[model samples]
Target: MPPSTVNRQWLLERRPVGAVAAEDFRFNEADIPVPTDGEVLVRSLYFGYDASQRIWLTDDGGYMEPIRIGEPMRTMGIGQVVASRDPGYQVGDLVEGFLSWQDYVLARGDGPMPLRVLPPADHPLSWHLGVFGVGGLTAYFGITDGLQVKPGDTVVVSAATGATGSLAVQIAKALGAKRVIGTAGGEEKCRWVVEKTGCDVAIDYKTDNLDARLRELCPDGVDAYFDNVGGDMLDTMLLHMNPLGRVLICGAMSSGYCDVKMQGPSNYMRICTYQLTVRGILLFFYRDRLAEGAAQLGEWVREGRLHVEEHVVEGFEHAPALLPTMFTGKQPGKLILKVADPD
Candidate 1:
């Protein structure tokens, strides 16, 4: 437990108009909250950053409640149970779930994503917020179930350097994809994607002519496209997909996630003309199967088939500053902020 009695929090000061900035949050200290019946008091250890957090700031909150002003910033965090009023959780137990940008947070087991009791593992606890967390799990299901990528298929993943995209590339290969292609912004990132994630070819979206490259590299047309970027990239990929090809809409990083509104693919007509199967992935839908996904991911990791990457920033003060980097350029892999250590 933290020695300080006051809770350190970063509250949403105002709704962001465009890109989120650190000024949007105000730092304040308040008395540590106590858990009531059916509630668990968690001391946050690490906070995982996701693009969806920006959507949560919107009025609609996407699929969950909006982060109102004066409330602690919401995040998917790993924490230790310092106190519990719920029968399922006990003090000293470690958990992962929806927490907030504070030293202590009150959590309940009945939220859309319940508090998960983390079992002992040989991996680092932070791995639970990364490879075993949302990004890795999303990548697992998105490739295996959403796109149904199979052997001898040509698979392509955009934002190849991102947390989910990085893993999606490898998972597709593990599924026996004949050709695994990835898209990154530059030559360095493109090279890194191919080297680190086992991508057969990496397209430098910034320098290379994407359509031509896809035509030249994937002469048979892309069989499966794991789209992390929407907008123009989605439109381009739509035109290159083989008949009966599959597409998984995982994210729209192109929009910057500033507002809820996003541009739809202009070449969506190809979905009909080519008889393509397009699907969207929201981890909430596969909440029950998360363990199954994680288990497979673990096996692949142990077998040296999957690579895990993380960009960890220390100190809670850096939380607000790190969020905007998701839209801007950031290093490859999962982005995490270390707040405190568990007792």
Candidate 2:
């Protein structure tokens, strides 16, 4: 079959106020981009919609520059090299990297070192978004560096059933966390966290009294906290930290979309008194150490020492709906959008 002449993509209509509305983004089509000299045309297979990118949209100047108004929205996607003008990539070779939210991506060979294509491991394709991809890498680094939880140390993760948190739970257990405590929004998510990750304690914030439950679970006080959702959960956990405890602040989804001012934790002052260490983490900021993380996580997955959670949405048009699910805290695991071949 012949390749299509047009490419479809989602473009920003306006900067979002709070929660993004359907009208905030527009679907547009362009002539399928031709690969210039030293470039490759990639047909996107899967697109990632994560909380980190959403945070980028909300504010300017994080690590990378913000997506300018009226431009194609940015995301991380995996695709196959369909046509190449560069010797490095051949037709049908798979690659993953920062991409526009579109069905076809033109990767500049001269652009920042393109992520090398690798043989798909024993896991499902969606694993690239969940356990084996950036989500997994965050979990891997948080446990190893940010928290430095030892084999017998008790570890707790907030947003416990989401993409990164779910994997963190499993990784902690794999590394021998004596007690793995997970805090999720509801009974269903909490139960899944416990069952899937074999966590020692799972708290459903929707029903459980967080302070009371956490105190009971970690009678010795928590050794490490891998926090994804911040706000009150952080406040509650701070009060329960053991002396010299470590905290990794990975996300603050609870405060991300609010129009009003977010509340700060009064208990945060306890950090000095308890000798607590808190580090706010942006996974991409540690891209220099990505190889170290991928090596450890990949080995674990290959040996069946880790499990991946994935939710695959077919078709590129479904990209906009993916983010709101994360905002509402409704999506299960990592969310990926599947696109058809370019031809």
Candidate 3:
């Protein structure tokens, strides 16, 4: 058992109107919760920062249930099982799943994304939340299944310096893509995308003329597009796609996730004219194949075909502050907060 009897928590004070701020969450202490039937008590170690957390704060909560006021902020986290009423989880087992912003969390294994019992591995435990977790698994399935990237195909990935995009760039290369193009906000991030993720060309979307760069880089037209920053970027990419090309609508970071009601792309008519295959990816749909995706990602990592980058902040107090940076400029790769070390 932990030395402290109180559970340290960051609870939602109220939903934000536009941009999320640190003031929106209130830090409090309460008695540690006890697990009942089929539930496990978890001691959190790491918390992953995702843009979707902002969507959860909305009235509709996008796909999942909305997080209520006064409740602990929801997050994807790694924790140690301290106590268990469920047969699937045992005390001392490490798990990765939906954990809240608290020192201790009561988790069940039957959710859409189950509380996975992490196996012993040579990689860092936090990697399960990044490359081997949602970000990596999503990129793997999104490229392999959603976009159906093939050898000799020209691929473009928006938000290339991000957690999922960074991996998606390299995964496209690993699968023998003829050329991989990445788009970032600035020259530094664009350069980093090419240097770190092996992107054939990096477009500075903030400064560069996206249409001209796409025309020059992908003369034959983009065969596959991994859309992370939707809105105008999606609209522009649609006009450059080859006929029968594949597009994956993975995220819309440009909207800031402040509201779920976003404007659709103006050039969506191109989808019909080009006969493009546009699809959206939700990790919940591939829950059963998570391990299979992880295995492939692990193999790529070991073979030096994939690169893992993380921007990790320490301490529970910094959680709220780090969240706002997800929409703003954050460093390349997965954004994580280290709360505690497992026993």
Q: Please rank every candidate by TM-score, starting with the best.
A: 3, 1, 2
Q: Which ten residues in a row have the lowest lDDT in candidate 1?
A: 1-10
- lDDT of candidate 3 over 1-343, digit per residue (tens): 3336989999999999899999999999999999999999999999999999999999999988999999999999999999999999999999999999999999999989999999999988899999998999999999999998899999999999999999999999999999999999898999899899999999998999999988887889999999999999999999999999999999999999988899999999999999999999999999999999999999999998888999888899898999899988999999999999999
Q: How big is the positional error of residue 200 in model 3, measured in Å on the Cα after superposition?
A: 0.5
Query: How far off is residue 331 in model 2, in Å?
Result: 3.4
TM-score of each: 0.98, 0.91, 0.99
lDDT against the true structure, per candidate, is 0.92, 0.79, 0.94
Q: Which stretches of candidate 1 lie over 4 Å from their true place?
A: none
List, residue by residue over 246-313, the lDDT tens digit for candidate 1: 99999999888877888798898999999999999999898899889889999998998988999999
Steric clash count of candidate 2: 0
Give stretches of model 2 more than 4 Å off. Answer: 1-3, 37-39, 59-61, 85-88, 108-114, 257-263, 341-343
